[model samples]
Target: MNTTFGGKPHVLILGGGSVGLTTASELRKTLGTEVAITIVDPRPYMTYAPFLPEVGAGSIDPRNVLAPLRKILPGTKVVTGGVSAIRSADNTVVVTTEDGAQLEIAYDYLVVGLGAVPRLLPIPGLAENAIGFKQVEEAITVRDKILANLAEAASTKDPKVRKRLLTFTYIGGGFAGGEAVTEAEDMVRDALRYYPDLHASDIRFVLIDAAPFVFPELTEDQRAYVLNQLRERGIEVKLETFLNSAENGVIKTSDGDEFETDLLVWNAGVKPNPILMDEESSDLPVVTERGPLMGKLDTLADLRVNGAEGPIDNVFAGGDCAAVPDLASGEGKFCPPNAQHATRQGKRIADNVARSVQGRPLVDYYHKNLGVMATLGMYKGVGRLMLGDKEIDVRGLPAWAMARAYHVYAMPTLGRKAAVLAGWASNLVSRRDIIGIPQSADPRAAFELAANSGPKKK
Candidate 1:
């Protein structure tokens, strides 16, 4: 180990999502010049997730929503690679680069903010038939696919083929599924003007969830309003219904019902990023109740990972990867994996890391609930805001405006936010760009074709 700490302990943060970036920034601010900081991840930028729906709808350029790490984090050392292994015994981590190069990084304090990935279930044909709704590329790809399906349906005269192309199904009713379906539905409805033969009525939209509600974030009254609104728009809201199989655009529901569709969106749920449970963490610390370190609250703090007994030092964890308890609710349920909580916890983790280095007292994290909002379609939305003791529900354009305003402020930077707003304005004034960039189906076929080609004779 290089002992050139210069009396400053080195801090290493994993992942580059909202939580990781926020924590890094906070640590830099609180530690003054005493701490050396480094952040590692495969990507060099953090994506502003709330604007993802707008990106899918082409109302915002995807580039505007992602903040490059080198740009946003000027002082922190940003390493672009994956943390391949964690050697906890020696307090060192192994990171692998895209070119097969690897390095061992030593840290006095380590924060694991590796965010969650989409949960893949063991259902047959799902890996091939369904597409996930996370990530910027998925949003753009879905937009292109939806528009392409529309074009194909309009050109085909066969009723069965057209129906198959126009049908779309989403398998989860959470925030991701709700936003994806709503934004896609709204854009397709508007783009129908280009296809004179296909109207909104010709398209089929189905939202299926095993749970009995659409948005778990909404109040009972607000949830009911959302359900009724979706029904009024002629979209099927199938609750308590789980998809058994989707083969060749045909889906079997839990109720033994079957349907044929072109699009299948899987937003069911997310598990901890597998990297968290790797060999690096074989003897890593965990939060537990009634331990020697911090008490029951130790396991529930923002960054500190308590052992089977209590708080463990030199390591921290947060975001969707850690099961941080919600103090607001007396129940022991872990905080739901949402952008709101992750962002907040990230800041707290940074502050705590800085404080520990300075030998200062660390603080506990407690937050009140912020209401949830969702857009149904063009000018329609629902919001459930928590007041002192009760919840207030609103719908229609007001809710839509609220949603837009909240996201505008929540965007990473002012400049990017302005660019997104400009895109929205431009979209309102002109036709939607629905062009698809075709990619080669068989990448290796190019090499084969090149090898087979002979020189042309003059």
Candidate 2:
């Protein structure tokens, strides 16, 4: 570790999601040449998760939702790799690059913003069939898969095959699942106009959740309104139900209902990044509680890692991977793993780290919940905003506009915001892009086929 005060302190940040990216940007702006920062993540860009639903529905281009890390953080070093192990005791981390080479990076300060991964259940055939909705790539895949299914279903004369292709089943009816299914249904409805054989009534959209209600973030009235709106659009909301199995395109539910679905979307939930729980990272204290937040790094209100004895020296953590205290929510409550909290926590932790480095006092992170918003479809949505002690409920077009405007303002860069707006504007003036590029899933298949087709001509 470079302990010399005369040289710039090396700060190593894990993950390049909203939290990590925000921290690096803020630190670079504040400390300038006083600190050297390095960020390590598997992806080269940060996906604006809030726009993922729109991306999946073709409302926004996939590239617009992603902000390249290196471009945004000009002064920082961005390493595209996955952290294999974190030996924090010695201030070293082993990162496995894409090419299978490993590099050991040492730092004077460490930031844990590794983010979370999809929490998949062990239902039968889920691993082989289900698609996730966490990243930009996943969103693009979902969009393509839906379009492909719709095209295939339109051409198929077999009733069973058509039904299977048209049926889209989504598990877990939280904000992610609810918004995704609704937007997808809207896309399918819009696309059906071009397919003479397909009708709105022929499509089946099922949203199944173990909970009795969806969108737990919304109030009772808002939830009811959202549910009613969905049902009015011919969507099946199976509450208090669980997916028993999804084998061979057959969906078996806890209610004993079985159906076939070619598109199975799994938006169940998310857990902290597995790196925090890996045996190699045993040195870091992790939450052992059996819940959604299990395996997260145990962190104090100041965003410092809580070791067995006390706060770990020169180490801090925030974002989805860290169990940060929700100071505004009273005692024993940790911040939820959402983009809002993650982004705010990132800025706070960055300031605290800078303060600690400059021998100044560290500040604790505290922010009140700003409520939640979800766009049901085009020109339709619901939202609940917290204004002091009072709550304001919004629905329909205004809510949709508010959601879009807020996301645009919150998006990291002006370039990305403009791109997203351009995409939306282009969609307004033109028809929705229903064409699916099936070759994207396997780009090399055509090349490989041609290569194996007999010997080269003399």
The runs of at least 3 residues in candidate 1 whose Cα sits more than 4 Å from the true structure, single-residue gaps closed, are: 1-7, 279-282, 285-298, 331-333, 438-458
lDDT of each: 0.78, 0.90
lDDT of 2 by residue, 236-332 (tens): 9999999999999899999999999988999989888898898665479999989866899999999999998999968889988999989999998
lDDT of candidate 1 at residue 131, scale 0 to 100:
85
Q: On a 0 to 100 scale, what is the lDDT of residue 292 in model 1? A: 22
Reference-based lDDT, residue 4, model 1: 56
Candidate 1 differs from the real structure by a C-alpha RMSD in angstroms, to one decimal, of 3.9
Candidate 1: which pairs clash? 286-306, 291-309
Q: Against the true structure, candidate 2 has what lDDT?
A: 0.90
Question: Which 10-residue window in model 2 sums to the lowest lDDT?
Answer: 1-10
For residue 430, model 1's alpha carbon misses the true position, in angstroms, by 1.8
